[model samples]
Target: MKAISYSRYGGPEVLEFGERPDPKVGPDKVLVQVRAAAVNPVDWKAQAGYLDTIFDTVFPVIPGWDVSGVIVQPGVSVTEFSVGDEVMGYVREDVLCHGTFAEYVAAPVRTLARKPRNLGFEESAALPLAGLTAYQALHRALHLRSGDTLLVHAASGAVGSMAVQIARHLGARVIGASRDEGQDRVRELGAEPVPYGDGFTARVRELAPRGVDAALDTVGGQVLKDSAALLAPDGRLASIADGEVIALGGRYYWVRPDTDDLTALAGLVEGGALTVRVAASFPLERAADAQRANMEGGLHGKVVVTVDHDH
Candidate 1:
C-alpha cells in the first residue's frame, strides 16, 4: 500500500510519497479504495501547522480530508453498502483517520454516503469539504429561503462556487463579490458579481438597497470584519475558516463531517440542484504539487489527487 505522509508540519516538502501499511476497518467502519480526493486550504494550513491546536495532530500526518471512493470492504455491522458501491465523505476533523491521500481509508458508516448519481468520482471528491461548508453557511447558518437577498464573498473559489449555486437553489437572490477577472464566471453561476476591493461592501449595499439578509464570508482577518458592516438585524455572517467574528453580533459556524448532511447533499446533486466543479487532477504521488497549485490561488475549483489513476 502506497501513501503520502509527513513526519512533521512544514512546507509541501514535508509530504512524502511511498509505501505504508494498509488500513483495516472496524466493525462499524468501511474500507474505501480511494479514487480521488480534494486539496483544500486546510490541507496546506495543516501542513503549515496552523491546525495544531484544532487537530492536535500526532506526528507523521496524512493531510487529505475530502474523498470519493469505492467500498472495497464493508464492516459486518454496516448493512447500507457493500463491495463495489461508490461513496464519498470526509473523515471527522477530530479523528486521526489516515486521510484520502492514501490508497485506502476507513471511515465510520455514519460518515459515508453514496455519491451523487450525476457526479463522476472526481466531481464527487470535490463535495464533502467545500460544498458542505457552503451548504451549512447559507442553508443552515443563514436560515436562507427563497426570494431572500444574500451576499457571498470570494464567489469563484471552491466554497464560493458551491455557495453561489446553492444559494440560488435555496431561492436567494445572490450577489457575489470577486476579483474583476472572476466576475464573469461568478455571474454564470447565477449570482451577480461585485468586484472585491476597498468599497466592496458599498457595492453590495447598492445592489440590495435595504441591505442583505445574510453573508457567507470565506476570507477572514480584515475580510471578515469588512463584511460584518453589511449585515442587517436579520442578517447572518458565518465563516468556515474563522470564528472570531461570531461575537460581533454575527454568527460563526464551522463545518464538521456528517453522513446526515452528506445524504442531504447527495439528494441535492441527485435531483440536479447541487454540483461541484473540479479544476485539476493529479496522481497520488504528486499530491504535494497539487497542494502547491491550490495554495497559489488561481484555480476556480478543487484540485484533486487521484489515488487509483488507472481506474
Candidate 2:
C-alpha cells in the first residue's frame, strides 16, 4: 500500500510518499481501510523527534493518530466491530509504527468507536484526538457541572473549540480566550470571548467577576499561567499543552484512548451538541503539506489527509 513515512526523525523534508507493507491485523485489533486522517501538532512534533523520550519510535514510521475509516477485516478476538463498520479513533500506542496516514491501519479495539452518524469521513477524522482532549479535560479533570463558569484557553483552536461546546452542553457558562481575530468564533461556540495575552487573566475575571469555576488550557506558557490565576479558590484546572501546570497545582493532561469517551462524543455530535470543523484537506500523498499546515498554526479547525483507495 502507498503511504507517507520517514525512515529517520526530522522535519517534513524527511517524509516520503511510497509503498509500504500493509499493517498486520492482530487479535483484538481491526484492519481499517483509511478514508481520512487528521493532522495534529503532535504529528509534526513527533516527526521532529520532540517526543522521542515519551513514546517509542521505530524506523520507517507512519506519523498520524486520528483516523476515520471503514473496517475491512476484524481480528479473531475483535467483537465490538465487524467488517464494513465505519469508525473513528485516536490510534496512539506505546510505540509509533503503523498509523492512520496510510491506506490501511490495524487499530486496536480499545481506541475504536462508531463514527458519528451525522458526520462524513473527513469530519469524523478530525474529532478523535482533539475532541477527546477537550472532553477529558472538561469532564474528567475539571468535573464541570451545570451553572459553573468555565474558562478555556486558545478557544478557537481545534481542542479549545470542542471544549467550549462540550462545556456548554454540560450547562457551564463558558469564557473562551483567543486572539482578537478568534473572538468571534469563540463567541459563536457559546463562550463569552476573552482576548488572549498580557491581560488574559484580567479579561477572564471580568467575564466571570466572581471567578471562574474551572479552566482548561490548550496553549502553554503564559496562557496556563493566567488560567491558574483566573480560577476560583475551589476551581479545577487542566492543561494538555502545558507541563508546568503541575507546579501551579493544576493537572497536566495527555489524552488517553477511550472508546467510551469517543462514543459519548459521537452521541453529542448526533445530538447537535458538538461539531468538527475542517480547516483544510490534503490527499495522502501530500501528508507532508498537511503536517506543515498544522505546524504553521492559526488554523480554526483540523487539517485532514484524504487517502484515495484506488490510488
Candidate 3:
C-alpha cells in the first residue's frame, strides 16, 4: 500500500511517500480503506518529537489520527460495523504508527463511529480530533449548561470553532475570541466575537460584565491567564494547549478516543447543530504539503488529505 511516513522525528522535509506493507487486521479492529485524513497541529508536533515523552513513537511513523473511510474488513470480534460501513474516527493509540495517512488503517472498534451521513468524507475526516477536543472540553470539563455563558479562546480555529457551536447547542451564550479578521465568522457561529490580545479580558467583560460561567482555552500562554481572570467565581475552565491552566485552578485535557463521543458529534451534524469547515484538501501523496499548510497557520478550518483508492 502507498503511504507517507517519516523514519525519524523532524519537520515536513523528513516525510517520504512510498509503498509500505498493509497493516495486519486484529481482533476488535477493522481494516478501513482510507478516503480522507485530516491534519492537525499535533501531527507536526509529533513529527518534531514534542510528544515523545507522552506517546510511544516507533520510527518510520505514519503521522495522522483523524480518518473518514469505509470498512473493507471487520475483525472477528467487531460487531457494531461490517464491511462497507462508512466510518470516521480518532485512531490514537498508546503507540504511534500505522495511521490514517496511508491507503488503509487497521482501526480499533472503540475508536470508530458511523460518519455523519450529511457530510462528505473530507468533512467527517476533520471532526474526530478537533471536534472531540471541543466537545470534551465543554460537555465534560466545563460541564456547560443551558443559559450559562461560555468564553472560548481562539474561537475561529478548528477546535475553537467546534467549541463555539457545541456550546451554543448546549444552550450557552458563547463569547469567542479571535483575530479581527475572524470576528465575523466567529459571530456567525453563534458567538459574540472579541478580538484577542491585550485588553482581551476587558472585551469579554464588556460582553459579560458579571463574568462567564465557563471558559475553554485553545490558544495557550496569556490567553489562559486572561480566561482564568474573567471566569465567574464558580466558573469552570479547561485548556488543551496550556498545561499551566492546572496551576490556575483549571483542567488540562488531552483528547481521548471514545466512540460514544464521536456518535454525539455525528448526531449534532445530522441535526443541523454542527458543521465542519475544511480549509483545503490534498492528495494522499502530498501529505507533507498538507502538514506544511497546517503549520503555516491562518487556516479557518482543517486541511485534509484525500486518497484516490480507485486509481
Worst 10 residues of 2 by lDDT: 196-205
lDDT of 2: 0.91
* Candidate 3: residue 105 Cα off by (Å): 0.2
Task: Assess the local accuracy of residue 24 in candidate 1 as a C-alpha lDDT between 0 and 100.
Answer: 78
Q: Which residue pairs show collisions in model 3? A: none
Question: Candidate 2: which pairs clash?
Answer: none
Candidate 1 lDDT over residue span 35-87, tens digit each: 99889888888778876776777666777888899999998899989999999
Q: How does each model score on lDDT?
A: 0.84, 0.91, 0.93
| Model 2 lDDT per residue over 1-311, tens place | 98899999889999999999989899999999999999998988888899999888888899899999999999999889988999999999899888889999999999989999989999999999999999998877888999999888888999999999998999999888889999999989999998866776776666778788898988788778878888888888899988899999989988999999999999999999999899999999999888889889888999999999773
Best-performing candidate as measured by TM-score = 3
| Candidate 1's TM-score | 0.95
Which portions of model 1 show Cα errors greater than 4 Å? 309-311
Candidate 1 clash pair list: none
The sequence of per-residue lDDT tens digits that candidate 3 reaches over residues 190-283 is 9999997678778889999988999998888888888899988998989998999999999999899999999999999999999999999999
Q: TM-scores, in order shown?
A: 0.95, 0.98, 0.99
Number of colliding residue pairs in each model: 0, 0, 0
Cα shift from native, residue 280, model 2 (Å) = 0.4
